[model samples]
Target: MTSDRDWTGRVGDIWATEWRRTDRSFERLAPVLNAAIVAAAGPQAGTIVDIGCGAGATSLASAQALPDGQVIGIDLSPKLIAVANHRAGSLGNVAFRCADVASAVGMHAPVDLYVSRHGVMFFADPVAAFAQLDEAAAPGAALVFSCFAERAANRWAVETVAGADDASGPTGAMTAPGPLPLPIRPMSRRC
Candidate 1:
């Protein structure tokens, strides 16, 4: 499991540095995910939160898609937040913040939509984290996110980290909690 400390420090720095590559890696999935988010949010969505927004690509895209809506990208990495802010430039509808979305969601209360791209996988306690988001959301708020299919399904990811290993052991496998083939199962239900 990736800890908050990792995101706040070395891991975060690496992501910030390699954000361009990371974004490119998600090129195929991003459009599909963004389209789902836009469809869920609709044009009248007043406020949207991009949970675990790394370099703000999703946030920027959503902001551009919904010019009348406000989009806030929240992440645990200061470096990532910096990159996001820099990329945002003069976009009036989007903003980035370095903070835990579980705790910070309340700050942007009544959010009309919540979106992520393989971001929620790192949460230590996803159930509790999502509960908080539920609490802070508007009556008809929509949540949309995407996570990796599985170790086998995503050959690109496995190949990319073929030799990498963390404290868990030397399997070169990701240690995120939940189902092996599909992590989305936990959050699949409608409220």
Candidate 2:
């Protein structure tokens, strides 16, 4: 990993080895998550752009559920993108982009939905990032993302299940003050 690039881009190198080896634990959670999210979004969601779509789990689910719509998973990690592509194969109307989401919207055309799985939260300039995504989404586009209410929740879960290295920080909130003066919907509701 380059010292200059952001950690989000290097997530695969940092976590892939560990997660890829994970038995069926993640697989078991897939169906449970897919049903809840797909049902909540309803059946009308059009094209979806899955941001930070590690391994394409959510992306695949969206595509499977919305056969009429397309899904494009975007992430900064080449390895993760590759894995996602390899696993999904030619499921018509599905793509993956290995570019930084912060600047990628400018290069790509807009879509009907901007989805993310624990993505879109780690940006140095969220205002710019949100604006980019805001512009990229089609009018009335819905964003379906499943993120940790707390970043350390997953880590803590793993720690509880399997002993962790001694060097762990206390559970803390991971957020930044907004750059724009406008009110954000606290990620609980659409902005």
Candidate 3:
């Protein structure tokens, strides 16, 4: 049986080995991530927690926005966290920790804002991890994260898949880029 610790360790090992290469791509997304966080949290986001903060670029950017506030960048990979800390040098309000957020409930201060850029998807238990993050935040705190809906919704991915498969990539179900009716409905009750 695969224990939780074992799984977490394995994940950390994989990222530790791949962080150098992955960091290059992740660096490019910092601007977009900043935009998303700014839009969601608005100006003056106090006490932010960045989940799955790979190399802490988004975390550093967020800390810059909140000069008086604090930001904690959390990740499972020790190597990535170390890099983040090294990069954080003279930044007093910014800090990085190697931890599994899903299991670190009540370990953080109540945050005014929470940001995750392409980071929330790696959770072993996404619902539980989100619940933990929610618990760690103050009431009325804003949660902001971006994720691509599906392969069909992403233009670059669609092009890549089409080219890879001789121009034949998932017919019929793929919705073209435009307004498409969704089956979603407003929730009448709060969970």
Candidate 4:
């Protein structure tokens, strides 16, 4: 059985190789995606943590969006992080680190905002990882992320990949703000 570190290392290697060839395509989407995230999270004034920030596109965007804030983009691929750092040249408010967020140490604590661009889904232990994130976030800090939907919901990609399912399953909410129940769905009647 592979340990968490081993598993994450392998995953990182795979992404590093894949992103080296395709990172540019994702960079093209950063503007729109970053705009939406900045709009939703509003302008951050403190620190923002960008989990799995490949090539630092989102992190650079966050830094640009929040001039007063510091952005830290963490990923497990040193090669990708290198590219991210190169791309972030002269960006005083932004930095990228090559480390696995699931077990990464020295996270900037009391983070004002924690943003993940399709990052959390790859955690070997989602609950534990989020627990660490929850501890890192300040009280009332905002958390925002986007993940791919179910396989059936992404038929185009499935068909394009020759009917091979990537098996991207949902991890559900690991924790919620305050005492709110996970998901925070609407109720038919008042509780």
Please list the Cα RMSD from the true structure of every candidate, rounded to 1 decimal place. 3.8, 5.6, 6.5, 7.1
- For every model shown, what is its TM-score relative to the native structure? 0.85, 0.70, 0.70, 0.71
Please give the distance, in angstroms, between residue 156's alpha carbon in candidate 4 and its true position after superposition: 3.1
Model 2 C-alpha RMSD to native: 5.6
Give the candidate number with the greatest lDDT.
1
Candidate number achieving the greatest TM-score relative to the actual structure: 1
* lDDT tens readout by residue for model 4, 80-170: 7877898899999998887877556235887777777767556666678878887777766776665555434566644654644645533
| Per-residue alpha-carbon lDDT of candidate 2 for residues 103-128, written as tens digits (9 for 90 to 100) | 77655555667777556655556678
- Local accuracy of candidate 3 as per-residue lDDT tens digits, 1-191: 22335424775566666766766766667677788777656666677788778677788888887677688888777777877898789999898888886666357757777788766655655567778777777777877765554555668867886779477755554322211212222232111
Candidate 4 steric clashes: 0
Report the candidate with higher TM-score, 3 versus 4: 4
For candidate 4, the TM-score is: 0.71
TM-score (C-alpha) between model 2 and the true structure? 0.70
Error of 1 at 82 (Å): 0.3
How do all the candidates rank in terms of TM-score, highest first?
1, 4, 3, 2
User: What residue pairs are clashing in model 4?
Assistant: none
Q: Taking the tens digit of each residue's C-alpha lDDT, what string does model 1 give over 1-191?
A: 56899899998999999999999998999899989988998769799999999989999999999899999999999999999999999999999999999999999998999999878777877779989999998988888988867655667656655655652322544456432323233345433
Question: Model 2 has how many clashing residue pairs?
Answer: 0
